[model samples]
Target: MVAGRNVLRALRDIRSFRVVVLHPADAESDELVAQIRRIGCRVELIWPPRDGIPDSTDIAFLLFRQDALTDAILRSLEDRPLAVTLIAIVEAESPTVIEAVVRSGASAVITKPIRAFGLLTSMVLAHKFSTGKLISAEKMSRLQTRLSGARVLEQAKAIVMSQRGVTEPEAYALIRERAMANRSSIEAICASIVSTGDVPGR
Candidate 1:
């Protein structure tokens, strides 16, 4: 229950979150409520039988409370795309227990006695992972740029080695030196050499 302070601290700093604290909604949830005071979220202290729950909840916390563990409700969460990440805190989790919980659509399992910011840290990590979905053009752009550079280098190396009868390593070093001397990126230099078999403007 003292860990409630840690939970609130995490929640307060967060933008918004949906947390289901199963019975006994002890001091832990109480503290979290205070932290969530202005966060525009709902701290549902409920047993199962919840229908039409928001599917976009950022994270779900399971406190080893039975009321939160009915078969029908678990199915509802798992059967939909909303089943992103579930965190379970138990006193001790056996291999069987761990596997079952994981297979039940919970992504992470933490051992309890919830001490020294363990619970809070795990939850934060879970939130990050769930929200850190890829598809950003920045990441794709970097990837594509690297891929193009690699292809250009390969083509340049082939041109240098075939034309000058040198090893690939030597050809690469030569291209790099020329690029550096000209203050151009290796990709730009390689692209020119590949397309024309000679450095542009040289």
Candidate 2:
């Protein structure tokens, strides 16, 4: 539930995207590009560039085997941090190709001979994947904070028991009482006690 609320909100907020399509100009790819434009996205089409990197944008669609272009765009994506999601356009599925796609930071893929039916679905999946990754990172950070707080609480309880010769439960009760009186979290009060090496309100 913690990750759910944020992920759903992100999905709802994605209205229109500025999409970059990197593929050799062809009838099928062209038609797919046109459909994306009709959905109200600002679309840019480029046949892999020779020497320059693509500028950062909301999303990018990469055609496999365009090594130079994919590298350039991935470089740009890295510089921009979590600001872009890549969708790979591939002709067939294989272990090597799928590994390369993910390693390049692609969140989703569209199999080639592009079908209009699944194009939109792929875009949605990419956005969802990106949001899920962010949610996971946030959860990990909170978990780390809790772990650190637990260490602080343990140290504080030890100090209480040693200084007052009380049982562990008694020491914990003392810490909880102090926390309530000071209108702070048990972890915060414990941190103060641990740092000073003394139990307060003795």
Candidate 3:
């Protein structure tokens, strides 16, 4: 009972999302729009994929055709990394269709005839997957920056030690003191030291 209530709560939160549908105005698209509206999300229907997703869209239901994969569709997929939860509307399960879906970077896929079943599940899962991907990307970027800063700091310390005949700890202390005096970061001070072969305020 508790888990059921939690699921209902999540479904209620789905109403807050803004959805965009890029499928043509056919029966399939109509059914999709109707179901999405039933789920309580604001829906915008756009025929023929656009070059970019709208700025307000939180989720996008894009039609993926194996033969009709144009540059505009590909651009839409490439440009909105981690911004929109893409749910591919595929017509078939052929190898070609599967490959296109993979290349499109869709977080989840909804196979046609656009039935009500599994649509909600796909939307929920896709949103979760997109959120997780964004978080992971941010964490990886921060880690890379820290690693690069560490390497530069080490080089700066070596330069200081070679020039002043001091130990590594003393070199780092000098860098810290200069950083504090200038109201800058240690990494900024170290970067300066590495570039100029002379510490600031010395």
Candidate 4:
């Protein structure tokens, strides 16, 4: 019962999503749009491939044709800061097609003939995968920033030790005191100390 409620809630939430279909007008594209609309998502269809996704797009279904591939389509696949989930549509399982799908960074794939059977599953999984990737990226960025601040803090401590002939603990204390006095972060004080080669308000 709980799982069913969660599934229903998820479906309801998907109604607010804005989906973009980057495929030429045809039976397949029409079917895709119809199915997505039936699922209660707002759908927009575009052809000939634009250089970028629209700012309002929350999810995008991109058709990849081996022979019809263009620079504009590839540019559209380039990394953007938007939280858009990408689904690749392909007609073949050839190596070239697989390569294109990989390059597009699609989290899920829909094969030709566009059946409604797996469409919702693909959308849900792709969105979950994209959201996970974003969370992981944000965590990595935070870790990197902390590592950078550690390096700067250590460098600042070393400079203080050399300049004042104090021990490491004393140097750290000095830095904390300076940070508090300036109403700033220890990392900010450390950064300024390292960059200017002198402690502030000394």
Instruction: Point to the candidate with the largest lDDT.
Output: 4
Give the Å error, residue 182, model 4: 1.6
Task: Please list the residue runs of candidate 4 whose C-alpha ends up more than 4 Å from where it truly belongs after superposition.
Answer: 1-6, 68-71
- Displacement of residue 62 (Cα, Å) in model 4 is 0.3
Q: Assess each prediction's global lDDT (C-alpha) against the native.
A: 0.63, 0.77, 0.85, 0.87
Q: How would you encode candidate 4's per-residue C-alpha lDDT over 1-202 as one tens digit per residue? A: 9988977777777789999998889998999999999988999998865556787788999887777553457665686654799999988788888998888788999999889998888888888789889999899999999999999999999999999999999999999999999999999999999999888988
The lDDT-based order of candidates, best leading, equals 4, 3, 2, 1
lDDT of 1: 0.63
lDDT for model 4, on a 0 to 1 scale?
Answer: 0.87
- Residues 19-84, candidate 2, lDDT per residue (tens digit)? 878788999779878978866677888776453225556777878763555566556556554657
Q: Using Cα atoms with residue i matched to residue i, what is each candidate's TM-score against the true structure? A: 0.45, 0.62, 0.91, 0.93
What lDDT tens digits, residue by residue, belong to model 3 across residues 1-202? 9988867876777789999998889888888899899999999898765456787889999877766544467665686757688898888788877887788778998878889998888888888788888999999999999999999999999999998899999999989999999999999998998899888888
lDDT of 1 by residue, 1-202 (tens): 7788866766674556676544346665565544443445556655443662456655565554333354455567666453345666555555655555665656556665444345556667676455443334457788998998898899999998898799999999888888888999888889989989875544
Model 2 TM-score, 2 decimals: 0.62
Clashing pairs for predicted structure model 2, backbone only: none
167, model 2: CA deviation in Å?
A: 2.5
Instruction: Indicate whether candidate 3 or candidate 4 has the larger lDDT.
Output: 4
The true-versus-predicted C-alpha distance at residue 198 of model 1, in Å, is 52
The better candidate by TM-score, 1 or 4, is: 4
